[model samples]
Target: MIRIGTLNVGSMTGKSREVAEMMNTRRVDILCVQETRWRGNKAKEIGGGWKLLYSGADENSRSGVGIIVNSELKEKVVEVKRSCSRIMKVKLMLSEEVLNVISAYAPQAGCDEEEKSMFWRELDEVLTSISEEERVVLGGDLNGHIGTDRRVISRIHGGLGMGRGTKKAKAS
Candidate 1:
């Protein structure tokens, strides 16, 4: 079976080797990464026979998203779409079925409403473009908290989260 996981690396500099080692040890076939804080849009081999497909705001450190696939499945990569610094998609041919994987990073709670709205709108657009029959896996750093009290928002959270809701959480 194919194993997939999501990680918020915060920043990728000086941590590529460590991340690669962990992926190898864990046998993670694919990994969706958020907040990479990396610059540019490109794909590269980051050692340990792993390939990383990444995108960021620009040529400077900032929000970013990426997908890392082990060497065994790298040949199965059919498409890589870097929509923006906060969103990306990768399509892999898994045997007879095609799997669509998306990596998205939401604006932090302190960001303006417009930024948050744009993030959702962009993400929604990406989601809509994919066909219904394809298998899709979406993962990322949401940058929000569900809060400890789930009764009021039972439909959204299951009450196992810690801390109280923040102003942004309440507003949304």
Candidate 2:
């Protein structure tokens, strides 16, 4: 089985020592990191044995993504997309299978009703493109409390989800 880990590091510069310490202690086969604040000139291979693949913080602090693979592992980047913010594509060479991983950090809020709907609707469309049959995995700080309620309330529990989060999770 593939062991994967995702962490919203909240700006590595804010906690660089903590981030490095955690990574050193964990034996993560594949790691997805967000809010790295990585820069074009400053980002480099860190830690002793990690084969690093990463990108910097984009304008508006939009895209900051990083992936780490065991240096002994054979791998290549399949596709990289910085198009819609921090979503990037990387493919891994497992012993017997090729795995595809997408690292994403989505937009946090919208100004109005139309904008809010449009934002999530776009996320849904993107999710539809992936095939479950492929060895594909998505990891990042989605920033949506869909899987876990922030207020600890569900619609059935008298919350204001309006069943939107539930439907999106089911469909995609």
Candidate 3:
């Protein structure tokens, strides 16, 4: 099975190699990265046969999103869409199946409501554009909270999420 993951890299200026290394060690085939703060839309090779396709504002380094594909999957990319600085998507041909991977960065909680609304609207448009038969995977830092209670969303949440300030299990 193809392994996929996501991360909010904060800024991608000097972290491409490090991110690629981490993905290699983890055996991830595809990675969605957000908050790249990169300007312009372009694809760059980040060493070790990994490629990063990113989209960002032309004039500023603010919200941005990107997808990293390992050597095995890089050439399978069929289409790339940059919805905005905060959202981007890549379509890959995984054998006979089509996989649409999206990377997004949502506005923070304190941001104006209009901005947040626009982000959701754009995201919805992206989701609707994909064909029903195609597979979809979204990864990003959505900056949302479901509170400590999961009774309302247990069907989707699995009721295993930790509340704020909860200690994480140590990796042994």
Candidate 4:
């Protein structure tokens, strides 16, 4: 099985080596990085035989997302799609089936409601477009918290969440 992971790198300009080292150390096959802060859409080989596919707003240093594939799985890449700075997708051609991996960076809790709703709407569109038979994996820094109160959302949460309840949580 492939070992997938996600990280919010904050910025990636001069931290390529550090990120590569972490991937190698963790033995990660596919890594989804958020908040890259890089302003480009391109793929490059960052040492340790890793390939990074990144997308960001043009000429802007704000939101960004990317996916890194190890040398072994690098050749299996089928398609890469970048919808915006907050969302990206990478499809891998596996031996028996295709795997779709989505990397997303959602607006933080402090952001406006419209921004947050838009992020979810975009992400929902992406998720719904994929076929049921294909494997889909989503990873990223989705800012929010599921508190210990599981009775209200037991269907969604497993009752193992940490942190105290927020005003919204208590109200819900």
- Candidate 2, superposed: residue stretches over 4 Å from native: 14-20, 40-43, 60-63, 74-84, 110-133, 146-172
Give the TM-score ranking, best first: 3, 1, 4, 2
lDDT of 2 by residue, 73-140 (tens): 42444554442435555676566766777666655543345745664565565556656665878888
Local distance difference test, candidate 2: 0.59
Estimated TM-score for each candidate:
0.83, 0.64, 0.84, 0.83
Ranking by lDDT: 3, 4, 1, 2
Q: Whose TM-score is higher: candidate 1's or candidate 2's?
A: 1
Q: Candidate 4's residue-wise lDDT over 39-111, tens digit each?
A: 8789989999999999897876568999999999999998998888899999999999999999999887456
Quantify all predictions' global Cα lDDT against the true fold. 0.87, 0.59, 0.90, 0.88
Better of 2 and 4 by lDDT: 4
Scored by lDDT, the top model is 3
Tens digits of lDDT, candidate 3, 50-86: 9999999887656889999999899999999999999
Stretches of model 3 off by over 4 angstroms after superposition? 147-172
Q: How close is candidate 2 to the true structure, as a TM-score?
A: 0.64
For model 1, where is the 10-residue window of minimal lDDT?
A: 159-168
Regarding lDDT, does 1 or 2 come out ahead? 1
Q: Is candidate 1 or candidate 4 better by lDDT?
A: 4
Report clash pairs, candidate 3.
none
